[model samples]
Target: MTAIPSAELHTPDELLANASAMYASGDPKLFRGAILESITALEAFVQRTVFRSLEGRLDPLLVKWLEEKTRMDFDSRLSVLTQVATGLPINKSSELWDGYKKAKEIRNKVVHSGRKVTAMDVELVMASVRDWLSYLGTTVELEAVLLTLKRWVEQSPKPPIENEAQAIQLVAQYFHQSAAARITIEAEINTGGRRHRADMILDFGPRKVLVETKFPRLANNVRNVIRDAVEQADAKRQAANIGQACVIAFLRKRPEGVSDVVERHKGGGILSIAIETH
Candidate 1:
């Protein structure tokens, strides 16, 4: 998947970029992925707005319940978000509401029944997604919510890593907290002939970064390890439609000859960084 540089994009734009890429891919799974991201963008937006509106006064248990409820299946979640946000009942009279409902049906068809989705279906969903985004943006409170998220990203802490698992955890947490990138831990990606579990994935709209954390053993072949890491990163990138990869080697002790920060491997296919755990 081709991606525009996302170094300057806000969270929502990143999500939209992913949606656009998926819609353009001409693959059913890609289309489905696009639809899911589109909906997820709205869900996150709405949830943040709702939470902001409540002003940290909602009961802890109630807040948790609301969060879970907001995460219900697409249709239910959308309906709840619309109703809570607008205070207007979603009836047949509202074209935007109806359009979202239709989009939900299309998503279900592709996801549930293994039905082939058409380009038109993707177009319709995109339209609905845009409509929802626009609607949310028009409101002052929701717009403030969006700005808050962007600011929070600007103020986020750098990820701390001391071990292999912590490296993956901290990297994932860093992207998500700092840039509104969606983070997935231990996600399995198909590597052509087989599947491997990626330590983490940082999804930023059209572009994704696959991350791997390795704590190599004392007797492991260093050359072979580096070669395998580069190849694995490349394979996972292709499988996940990701454009970039980061492989972190948490060694028990710093190797004598290796560079601490070798930025890219195989001509930028991977970003290989090594850290000493001593």
Candidate 2:
């Protein structure tokens, strides 16, 4: 996934790096930015993750509701999201969540109480934030990644990809670079003693997702493309150790936003999504 290293803003990876640099510099003044960026980056990532991973799956009313909650408390966001979003909520009483809340308080003190932070504060916050990332990556992050790619067609930097290969390239690049996840393109899988190639594979630590992409200009093509990908996924699912696999379809807008996101499922438990791009 892309780490977002460009100059405009810092991604969590960049913010964490800045925190480390500031701590290494031994400049007490810089520690505050480090501390602030560290916490802010975590907050930013949570919102970004939620939107990119789950927005397309939501009803329009829920989309508006989430927009209104842009400034909602993080815990409240998590609480409400658990009601609507997939994946089990991180336990509030667990050490991981509790430690993160404690770290968040330190961040709040810096902003509201004008508290001066030292290197030790930076260390504590950094460790806790890193732990949070690790926990998410190893646990429920697979669901998050799969959910994100279910709307893979929406992530296209350029709309109207010309063919299946181009569509695969676009989403694969987006996930491999932006999601901070590992991916393999044109990966080979064996089924029924014969070998076939799947569009892509995504890795979230121990878990994985088999991805097949489709670009359908006509509405009728939607079902056919989805069926084709499901067959492919079913073939590779057993061979690849993937419990879940998905097909992402980018539909051209001749009718111009004629449809929102349409999802389909096969008996083999494969999911397919069609997102219109205008």
Candidate 3:
């Protein structure tokens, strides 16, 4: 038989250009794995460039760029970047960082060990990577990725929690009953001069307690609500003959490290109760 010559593959840069073209043409999945591989390659390139430029003396320009990009003080940028290299999102970024990390692990497994990559896996990794890229203003092939991610999310086996408002109401009821001695329960206090309903209030005979009930998932939002409630409570207390006043957050579940937070602000008469439900 006559010998046939096999064509040589393109260079990394050429492959990257081809991938970019495919992405631009709306064929994102055509070279999804290759694009991710390119990102890995680019990361290595950035690291090598940094190391080569920094030989012994650090470049002030590079230092300034790093500081500006991260919005961090000079001393913390290097440490923060080291953590970021391990796939921590920049700026303590998103609640989905854990999900992104899990997706990245799957990607690494597939790429390095030739493991089977499922559609779901690819979808998750693409979504997270695209989000991170968009946040950083980096170019990403999003259309196809988003489509795949949507499908994956739609096909996800978990059932969505329902009646979040009802759940919060239940938690508020629990807290009200539990603290009946020191706290007086009042529902739907119209405040904010707009008939805004306060979920529950704990009435201290002399000093009033404003309780804003929220789901455990909205723990961060509770902080601002608590702050506003504190100010409002103080205003109400001042307008009356109350001795001390504060706001308490009654959550469906305790947030991590929240007990310490409660203790820290307990001196200020503010309380946060993380309600445990059966």
Worst window of 10 by summed lDDT in candidate 1: 1-10
The regions of model 1 sitting more than 4 angstroms off are 1-14, 25-29, 55-57, 73-77, 81-92, 140-278
In order, the Cα lDDT scores of the candidates are 0.61, 0.63, 0.40
Selected candidate, larger TM-score, 1 vs 2: 2
lDDT of model number 3: 0.40
List candidate 2 stretches off by more than 4 Å: 1-15, 51-55, 58-62, 69-72, 112-120, 133-163, 169-183, 189-196, 202-210, 215-246, 250-272, 276-278
Candidate 1 residue-wise lDDT, 201-249, digit = tens? 7665545667776767662455466668879888888887776676766
State TM-scores per candidate: 0.43, 0.62, 0.27
Return the top candidate by lDDT: 2
| Residue pairs with backbone atoms closer than 3 Å in model 1 (clashes) | 18-205
The C-alpha local distance difference test score for the whole of candidate 1 amounts to: 0.61
Question: 158-216 in candidate 2: lDDT tens per residue?
Answer: 44567778777767665755444567888888877898888887765545668788787
TM-score of 3: 0.27
How many residue pairs collide in each prediction? 1, 7, 0
